[model samples]
Target: MKQDLRAVIIDDETNAREALSNLLRLVCPEVEICGEAKNADLGIEVIKEQKPNLVFLDIQMPGKSGFDLLASFEKVDFGIIFTTAYQEFAIRAFRFSAIDYLLKPIDPDELQAAVEKYKSQTAGLNPQQIQILQQQLDTPGTVRLVNRQKNDNQRIALPTAEGIHFVQMTDIIQCESLGSYTKFHLIKGPAIVVSRLLKEYEEILDNYYFFRVHQSNIINLEHIKRYVKGDGGQVWMSDNTEIEVSRRRKEEFLSLLSDFYVNSGKLK
Candidate 1:
């Protein structure tokens, strides 16, 4: 028998809080909704008391933001799955931290995926690494970045020929995989760096904004113009660049597109 994981929902919206809790109960019985809080203040207090294994955090909240709450805690013993309608700031945060999150209105499949990933990562992670990650959570300047250097696997301070290009998370048009490297196309840049593999970038970028539309391409939802119908169908970027959408990923890509447009206002 598997051990049941305890969780807390920390969202300002009561409806969203209850909805997520209900979904967890119905879809992922392994996750127990130990508590729920409407704001960061109460949420922090509940977190201290419950000491849950995981937290479903909301980026935007009344008074203090979720980022602020994370900063306030001296140590984050629990894994975080940020659920937000917005993507900009949250994407930046995820880029700096190897944190996992889901976008709203929460998808059951995404939630299940996050939980499974958390289980896999935490199951074998060294306590020293966890401590280092906790220290990173406490530090303000430490942000998540895709470390591409062969040296030490440390977070990069500057973009190198080998380091990841700091494209404004919103400005990235699409990422194309070329064997071991990925070419990132941005809104204003003509140059593309053949850096780390597509799987590496996929793990680094916020899943809410970027989706693997094909085995070779990861398209930014904000930059997608439309999906043109064809023998295999193609995804059109805001810059009018077209990329093949794999047949297996078409359904998930369409779902992400619908969510992106419907929640466009939250992008700001």
Candidate 2:
């Protein structure tokens, strides 16, 4: 028999908790509702007392937000599936950190997917990664990405067949689209194919100064070795991969290159 996965729902509203609990009851028979809490304080207490294996945490509460709740914990041992109302920034942040989340008015399909993802990530998160998630939430505005932090090891979480792997953003030379999957080429690692679209990764990596020179490719701006003008354009990547830029996207790519070079003081 499959063991029931214990879960606790932490939300500020009674309706929200009840709705999710009921939804889980209908869709997932393996999930056992261990307890529920109305706020982060009580949520922490329930977490300590019940010690459920999974927590469905609402991002917004009366006093302490979801980020605040996570900050309170010394170490997050169990799985967390965040529930939030749609904020463009929040959505991007979640993708950037590769965290599982359920949007408000949640669909059953998405709920099931989130649960499955949590099951796969049984090991959960460490303290520093958790802190980065907090940083992601607070970060939304676009700024020219610079390697200002000398000691910062900026990595993006990628889900693979083996498990979740964190790849340094700077190490990634380019990304290629394969229908629903996006394959990443890193500096010294084997190519990794993740179950996500190129556009999704493009959105998350663009903020970190990656550029989409083609519909099917997103290359790190710092990894362009040379550009050869063609019908549209061709660029040689640091790893020696050649990417094609569409004519329509050529101007945008050139402008981005201009900005990137100027920002990095490579161009006057």
Which tens-of-lDDT digit does each residue in 73-98 have in candidate 2? 88887788889885777787777677
Pairs that collide in candidate 2 are none
The residue ranges of model 1 lying beyond 4 angstroms of the native Cα positions read 88-97, 123-268
Q: What TM-score would each prediction reach against the true structure? A: 0.50, 0.86
Highest TM-score scorer: 2
Report the Cα lDDT for candidate 2.
0.81
* Ten residues in sequence with the least summed lDDT for candidate 2: 143-152
Candidate 1, run of 10 with poorest lDDT: 142-151
